[model samples]
Target: MTGVLIPGPGKRVTLRDVALEAGVSIKTVSRVVNGEPAVNAATAVRVAGVVERLGYRPNELARSLKG
Candidate 1:
C-alpha cells in the first residue's frame, strides 16, 4: 500500500523529515510543497526530489485549516 512508502510508522512523511533530507527548514519545504513563490529554483528542485523519493503526501485539509 501507499502507506508502506512513507517513512513514519503509518503513512506519512512529516515535513521535518523532508527538511532534514533537503538540508532546509520546515518552512522552506512548506513553501515548496504548497507552491508558494519566492523559493529558489535549486531549493525547490531539491525539496521536490525529496518529496518524490519519499512519497510524501501533504494533508490538504490540514493546510486549509491552517490557512
Candidate 2:
C-alpha cells in the first residue's frame, strides 16, 4: 500500500492522494488531517492509516497561503 501510494523519491505525497487511496473525498481527508471533530472515529482512523501509509502531509506553503 505504501509503495503503491508513494509517487517517487522526490515527490511528496499530497492530501488528494490520500483521499484517493482511502476511498474518501478530499474534504473528508482534509477534516481528518486538520484534526477536526466533524469526522467520525472509524473514518478518522481509516484516514489516519492511509495518511501514515502514504506519508501524506499538508503543504506548508499552501497552508501559509491559505492563512
Candidate 3:
C-alpha cells in the first residue's frame, strides 16, 4: 500500500485530486489527459504519473452534464 492513494469510501479520484498531487492546475491536467499541446513537458509527465497513480478517470456523466 506504500505510495498508493486510497480514496474515500464512495469517492472517485478526480481531476482536482491529480492536480493537487501533481502541483498543477486542473486545466493543465485536462490538457495532458486530452492530449492537447503546449503543456510544459516535465509538468505533463508529472501529471501523467499522478493520474496513473491516483487511478483518476474523467467522469463521463459529469462531462455529459456540462454540455
Best by lDDT: 2
lDDT of 1 by residue, 1-67 (tens): 1222346576578898788888889999999998999899999998899888887888889978996
- Estimated TM-score for each candidate: 0.78, 0.87, 0.81
**Lowest summed-lDDT stretch of 10 residues in model 1?**
1-10
Could you tell me which 10 consecutive residues in candidate 2 have the lowest summed lDDT?
1-10
Relative to the true structure, how large is the alpha-carbon lDDT of every model? 0.83, 0.86, 0.84
Q: Order the candidates by TM-score, highest first — what do you get? A: 2, 3, 1
TM-score, cand. 1 vs. native:
0.78
TM-score of 2: 0.87
**Best candidate per TM-score, number?**
2
The number of clashing residue pairs in each candidate reads 0, 0, 0
